[model samples]
Target chain A: MMHINDIDTPSVLIDLDRVEANLKRAQDYADMHDLPLRPHVKTHKLPEMAQKQVALGAIGITCQKIGEATAMADGGLTDIFLPYNIIGTSKLDRLVDLHARVTLSVTADSTDTVAGYAARFGAAKPLNVLVECDTGAGRCGVQSPEETVELAQQINDAPGLTFGGLMTYPPRGNIAQADAWLHKAKAALESAGLPPKVISSGGTPDMYRAAEGTATTEYRPGTYIYSDRMQVAFGVGTLDDCALTVKATVVSRPNVNRAVIDSGSKALAADAVPAPYTGYGHLVEYPNAVIIALSEEHAVVDLSACVDKPLIGDTVRVIPNHACVVTNLFDMVYLVRGDTVEREAKITSRGNMR
Target chain B: MMHINDIDTPSVLIDLDRVEANLKRAQDYADMHDLPLRPHVKTHKLPEMAQKQVALGAIGITCQKIGEATAMADGGLTDIFLPYNIIGTSKLDRLVDLHARVTLSVTADSTDTVAGYAARFGAAKPLNVLVECDTGAGRCGVQSPEETVELAQQINDAPGLTFGGLMTYPPRGNIAQADAWLHKAKAALESAGLPPKVISSGGTPDMYRAAEGTATTEYRPGTYIYSDRMQVAFGVGTLDDCALTVKATVVSRPNVNRAVIDSGSKALAADAVPAPYTGYGHLVEYPNAVIIALSEEHAVVDLSACVDKPLIGDTVRVIPNHACVVTNLFDMVYLVRGDTVEREAKITSRGNMR
Candidate 1:
């Protein structure tokens, strides 16, 4: 068995213990809420982890693209939900293949996306289409309940598609607001004679505050598997609950004020945490050390305010601002328990940017 | 033969014509300045691209990690420079293997890093160690000219290391300040009976302002090979000069003002350009469309400003904020000219964070 430090610098280390606890906590929360959990595979991008999530009672898995769903299917995942408007002939072709492999569902905010699915798929092997609602998030979703009902009607009318339900990428920390929007859309769809089967919702902090018997029958939380500094800032989890940590070596300690780590945007990723929380990551070793900036391969850290500073050649572990993006940046990650390295997990679905 | 449009959506599309022009322009500029252009391969991560840079009269290629250099060496690159203070034995072991494969030189800012090299390599094959200076960049390097001389002395005194010269990742748009600092360091090194042979300096914006008879012997520019929005904002190039572009399909047009593309933080990356220029990237086809926000796989575009808003299923190309990080996010990219697809180039050196 190898030690955690033995792994290469700038390598992603996942605490198996913390990951298990996080997984259990999320599942337990879902169970208490009486909702089926469909963990998004985009977080880990590992088929093994997705399988583990399913083994712990996840109804299925959520994928963003056909490529990721295909990987998860190949890894023995039977059901997958892609929560994005699947467009183009290339992706639709892959979707057809993935649909044949597993029980697949997709989301659509426009009739253009619904038409693509209807064009290829037939009534014999129908695809479930969820209507994505804005829900005040202002992202890729229909603006009003009327648009949601119209899109759902279009899906219901299509021979190859079924109106699965309503889903929303909501504004952070507002469960009631999302529920209200989805509730209006659900009522609208009900009046249109296309009663939804599953109302999907997610986001870590909001998921915790979700009330029972809401329109949402299921929740899809991706980042909770590896809670990050951003999640901590969002009032979801603490720093100790964060499972993923980037192990970087201090390549340069230029002065008493600053140090540079090998892990920069390329390794740790450049996704900044939602406000109030400054810096790219939380230096676990040096709690007060500020990761002021990041170049492609250099993480410039301000070490002056810290009681202890890292020296050149010293190893430091950093909890990144965002864990999902960080996972995508690495080809493989170490699953560790404290100082012990368990095994290397390949991010098989990484860069599945279809 | 496949059309460029026939390629998958959210794919990294490289305009070969634009790439060739970008390459030639940078090469001509370096030639005019009489500086041996050592193009950093961190931008493209393709060994083929690195070979092209070498063929276009680059002295060599600059890589951040040993993994990247090893990949380049495997692709027939003979000379390599790693502008990083490489620490830890895991990396040092790889360095020894890479040293045997190519002419290798590395940078050091501390004695700890120099000692690691000195312990590994012998006098017969001494490693040329460059003393990295701050020069107000304030990321990684010795703070003053005196510290640079002291580190140079340490490398020179070491049995298996030769004081190669000096290098600095300087502040943007300040070539003179960097040269002046290097001038003082060069003077100090000369007084200490250790005259430097090479004084390397780089930064796209500052590189253009670099004058002849300066202390900088050579310049390392990575993004110039594929000028990004950040480089454009830095006044290095315009949007038309950019070689790399992300082709994404309009999956959702929620309202008259709101549109969503399949490409998001995952595809375009989250590296924000230095001030004034806003949003994730420049929308090429719809120049006025603002990519307001990005989730993992959803680029939220605000299209209110545009007169000709893209309809659903329409494909749009985006020139990302930072091309290097964007390149790292994908495994393969489509090389195209006009509407004709050339071939798929594998980003083989991608995720080489080690």
Candidate 2:
């Protein structure tokens, strides 16, 4: 049993108890609202955690890339969904390989993407394709409900392609608007002689409310398992609920009110704290101290507001503003129950952007 | 004999010719000015590149951590410098191991860090310690010239430490002020019966002006070997001079003015382009296109300004805002000369934060 203190500085430390609690809460919420939780593996790319989520009543796992889906399937996960408009011939070939490994589904917002998928899986088990709707996120998605229906029709018409359903990663805390758009899209699809089998909605900030209406049949929350500072700022959870933190050692105390940590932009990530929140992260031990800025290997902290300043060589845990990006930064993360190390989990799907 | 176009999308492509040119230019500038170049490995993190720099008349390589120094040493690099105030027993032990393998020197801005180094190597080869002076960078360094001299004296008095000299990463384009501060510090150290052996000043933006006066004896530049968008914005180089680029395919063209690429913050990095740089990165093919924002796996590019808009599946090479952080994001980088793939270089010291 390795101790938590024995682990190296600037390592991602995940609390197993907190993770389990978070997992249970989300699953229970989904169960109460009659929604199947298809937890996104993008947050914690470790397939073991995905397996645990599936064991804890999650319907399946959700990946954002073909590589991630393959990693999950290798971990023995039977069902996986990639909710993105995947394009390109090489990627579609890899997607076909991934689909053969598990019950896979992918999202597409355009006919070109559907055509690529159709070309690759022409003779295989029918590839499930979901139409991605915008729903006010203003990212990569179809513009209107009618546009989604047309894309669904394209998927339905394509060889070896099944129109799976609809999915959207809506803006955080705008669940009502997403619900409205999803409702309209569903009605439009129904009128066009196609009803969505699965209406997947995702966003960690609005996860608890995902199953509140008829629009979302399943939820695909990524950051809910290891709630971070961003989630806390969004009122989704409190500081106590944040399970993942980067363990950093104070390498230098340049002045009375300034301390530099080993964790910089590489470990803590460069994701700006989405507003209303200030600073790069929240220090667990010293709540008043702020991570003012980060260079590549140094995190400059402001300690003027803190009642107790950290001395050089002091270890501090920091909840990153965004946890998903932080997971992608490290090769391995240690899982701990309290202060006892459970095991180290490899970030299997890390840097698998292709 | 693979072509550049044959490589996968979102892969790091290193132009060998541009890299060699960038290296030669920096080395020639340093040689003409009589400044020893101690190129920082934090940018490339490859021992092969560090060895190449040493071959090109670099005095040594500068690393940000003990692991990087050890990795460089393993690749047969004999001399290394870590410009960081290292603390903690584990890290100091690693530092001792690193020093045994190479002619190593480290920087300290605090008495605590100096004491830790002294206690660890009391009976071994005397550890070289450079007192880091804050020449208006406002990062991890001693506040004033007096403070730097005091720290140098402390290092000189320590049992197993040699007062190497003064080092600072000054603010870019403010070399005159840094020169004045470094000069005063050197004079103060001389008055205290401790003449500085080496005065090191670093920053790629000021690499050309490193040895204009007697303030610096050596220079440690990280990004000159792979000039990035930020360096270009600082007037260090142009797009043609950049050696590293992320090759990405346009995955989606949501609208006539909006395009999404396979590379995002994960590949290109999320380091905000410091002012006068209004976007995330510089696209080589479509220079006018602005990489306005990035998600984890998607770079949302605004193509409204580009006359030659890239269609879906078209590959574009992007020069990230900061190359150092981007280098750490990938496992392997493909090295190429013109259109032919030379080989792939493993980022040996990547994620060596500890």
Candidate 3:
């Protein structure tokens, strides 16, 4: 058996203990709130973890794409929720094939997407279509509660589609506004005799505040599984809760004040946290050291502020700003606890954009 | 046979015509300067494209990591230059194996990296090591020209290591400063009877300014093949010169002012160009329209500036801010000509961080 330190540099390491603890804590919170936990596979992108989530009382797994859902299905996951508008012929065709193999639910904010879903699916094997409401996030969603019901009614009246529920990627700071927006939509949906069975609202920033009495039936927080620096910046989790980290080798000490690591944007990702937090990532070993700049293959770290700096050959663990994007960059991640390497998990759903 | 439009959304499309033209133009510039052109494979990560570049009069290819070089070597590429200080034991072992199969030359800034190379390699099959110098770029490199020669002399004296050359990733918009820096180092090396054989300097921003009558012999430019929005901002090429693009479908039209595409940070990476160029990408069909925000799987477009907006089912081409990082995000790219997809080229070097 190999040890965790024996693994090569610029490798993603997942603390299995933290993962298990994070999973349990989130599941316990959802259980207490009476909301079904649907862990988004985007965090780890490994089907094994998704199955573990299901085993630990998750209702289903949320996949962002058909390819991700297919990967999860291949890994023996049965229920998948794709929280996006499934468009185009090739993608819809794959969705149809995936629908045959698993219980799949998808969301669409427009009638055009609903029509596309209806054209492929029939009443004999109905495809559950959820109306994605904008809420306060202001990305892709129905602008109003009336628009949500209009799209929901279209799905209900369509040949093969069923108005499954409503979903939204809520605002970060003020999630109650999202809950209130969905509450209005849910009332409109109920008035149309189409009360949603699943009202999904998600964001790691407000994972603890997944509304209790409102329309949100399930919570889909992806980053809660592998809490990153971005979640840390939002005050959602601490550095101890961060399950994912990039183990990079200090390849060069360019100057007295600077150290360069092997993990750049290609390994750690280019996602950044908000102000008060600086750099692309935080060095776990040296808390004061900031990863100032990232080239494609090298991260120039500022070590001036640190009392102790890493040598040219020293290895350090870095907590990335965003865990989900970091998972997408690598082909596999090493699952470990302490110094032991448990197993290597393939990032199955990475680059499954279509 | 499949048409380019027949491919799914958020897929990387590389235009063969533009690629060939870009190749010819860059090679022609190199030939005019009497400099050996070695296109870095980081942009495409396709060994096929690297092989094409070699066939188009390129000296060899530049890879950032040993695994990337290994992929190109497996694709029948013989000469590979890794412009990085590779550290650690496992990476060194792989480097030895890769060195055995190809003519490999690597860069080292510190004695620690040289010692690691000397430990694995033998005097019988010596490894060529270049000294990386920090010209104005505040990244990974020796601090001064004196430091460059010191590292070079150390490599020259070390067992089983030959001082190959001097290389620098020059600061953008100022190529002369880099040339002057390398000239000082070359003179110092000559005085010490360790004159360099190959001097390399590269950056897509100043690719056309390959120094002549200076210490620099070969030039490496990664993004010149598939020029991105960043390169365009640097005034290297126009948007039409971009061979690579992401074809994304408009999955949702939430309001009159905003539309959302299926492409996001997952497909088109989160790398942003400097000011004056905003957004994560540039839409070819709607130049005025801005991709205002990006979630993991959705790019929210502000279509208010556009006279014609994309519909729910329309597909649009996007030029990402950094084409190299975008290539790292995908598994394969569709090689296209006109409306037809020529072939699906596997991004062989993607996720080859180790």
Candidate 4:
């Protein structure tokens, strides 16, 4: 074990105490709502974290890609759900292999993708398929509830696919719209005699306001484990709930008001979303100063508002705009408590962009 | 060998033909100008790429962090220049250990950073120090030419430091100003009987426009190897010269005019700088359509003007907004020649953010 002061600069520190508390809080919410909690492993991507979540009474785990699912399965996670459309012949083959190792389910928005999955896994084992509906995000999935029923029917009729549930990732402020869409999709599926058994819906922003009804049987929230600046901006969690931070050193104080840090766009990630507030990212301890801008290897922090200005050798921790993307930036993370590094966890599922 | 069509989706494909051509082009420019080319390894961070650059007649390699330089040295690169200030005690200790392993040189702009280096490496080995001068970048380094000389004298008087040269990374359109500053700084150092043996000026955006009589003996440009959307936007390179691209699958055609890809901010990096371009990244083959938005695992591409729309399973390539950050996003890259994968290279030097 090492103290926080002893750890090297530009390292990722995760407060295990906060993480365990977050896990229990989310699990208790799911229990109160009588829904299975399938937390997305894409956030932490650590096997130990996944195991901890499962130990805290999560029904299973959720993944956005086959690579992430495979990584979770390799880490002794027996039940996994990939909530993204798995296309192409090669990826379908990997899906079949993953299904052989664990209880696996996947999402699809089109008949072509469903057909591919059926062709690959219909003979060996029926592939569990969930219809991905676009409530309002405008990113992926089927547009209408009618399309969702049609896709579910297609999966039911396919030789090697089974209609499992309905899934959607709605826009942040449009939970009402998502509730309406999910209810309508559930009705359509039941009318077609193919009602989804596991209706999943949740994102970090609207997890608290998750709609309760027959349409939502499970919730998948990834970012609640390590809330970031984006979640703070969206009013999801406070700064104390943010479990992860990138520890960086102030390498140069070029002027009185400005300083350059070793952690830049590469380390912190350059995901500058339009927030209600200013700055590239928020400093964890010193909230007054903002990360004004970032170069490739330098983060220019404006320290004008702070009462105690950071010197050239001072160390600071920054919570990025998005925690998931920041986890992908590093190969490993230090699981820490106060000042002691309890363990060094490898981000085994990182860079699994397949 | 794998053909381009046979390779897996979301894999980094580097065109060796274009890479060789780019290396030769930069070499020719440096040869014509009689300036040593020290290509920054942060763009690729591959040992083979660095070897190829050396084979193409590069003097040495430049890295932004100590971990990168250590990885390069472990890959048999003996000489390395880190163009950033070294401040922290732990990092300075590692710098001394690295100096013992290889020929290590670093840049510093302030007396405190210079003193840190002197305290660490002054007794065992004289630290090769370069005075970093601020030439309109407004990021780091000293402000004026007189300050550059004063810092140089401080480095010289320090017990275990040697003032080897001067260095600066100027903004794109201010090469003339940087040239004037470096010229004055060189005169000041000479008048103080401490002329620099190596003067380095770098920044890919201003590399082609480097002024004459700047007293710059070396030029460091990192992104010239794999030009990106930002480079193209800055009028640095054309689409034909871009050697790296992300091969992504069109997972969803949500609407008639929109297609969502498997690659998003995690794979492509969300460094959406120089806005009004409106995208996390630019489409490689289809230049008309813009990647309008990005979620964690979905890249929303707007295809309103695309005459021939991509199908649900079709694969498309994307050039990220910034190539260096994109390099750090992936773990491996496929070297290609005319649609055939020649070799798979591990990005071993990635994630060295320490």
* lDDT for each residue of candidate 3 in A1-354, tens digit (9 for 90 to 100): 789778888999999999999999888889888888888989888988998899999999999988888999999999899998988788888999999999989998888888888889988999998889898787999999999889988998987988889998888877768878988988998999999988888877888877543778898989989899999999887999999999999999988999999999999889879878999998999999999899999999999899899898889999999999999999999999988999998887788776
The DockQ leader among the candidates is 3
Q: What TM-score, computed on C-alpha atoms, does each candidate reach?
A: 0.98, 0.97, 0.98, 0.97
Candidate 1, residues A1-354, lDDT tens digits: the string is 999867878889999899899999889888887889999989899888998899999999999888888888889999999998888877888889888888989998888888888899999999999988888888888889999888888888899888899888778767778888888888887898888899988877666776542888998889999999999998887999999999988888888888888888998888888888899999998998989999888899998789878778788999999999999999999999999999998988899877
| Pairs of residues clashing in candidate 4 | A122-A160, B122-B160
Residue B45 of model 3, lDDT score = 84
* DockQ, computed on Cα atoms, for candidate 4: 0.83
Please give the C-alpha DockQ score of model 1: 0.86
Q: Give per-residue CA lDDT, model 2, range B237-262, as digits (tens).
A: 78899999999988777778988888
Chain B global fold similarity (TM-score) for predicted model 2 against the true chain B: 0.98
How do the residues A192-278 of candidate 2 rate in per-residue lDDT, one tens digit apiece? Answer: 988999999887888877766568988888899999988888888798999999999998888899999998998998888877778
Q: Identify the superior model by DockQ, candidate 2 or candidate 4.
A: 4
The Cα local distance difference test for each model comes to 0.88, 0.88, 0.89, 0.85
For candidate 2, what is the DockQ-based docking class? medium
Report clash pairs, candidate 1: none
Task: For all candidates in order, state the fraction of native interface contacts they contain.
Answer: 0.94, 0.72, 0.93, 0.91
Candidate achieving higher TM-score, 1 or 4: 1
Q: lDDT, candidate 4, residue B158? A: 88
Which is the leading candidate under lDDT? Answer: 3
Q: TM-score chain B for all models.
A: 0.98, 0.98, 0.98, 0.96
Segments in model 2 whose C-alpha atoms lie over 4 Å from true places: B122-124
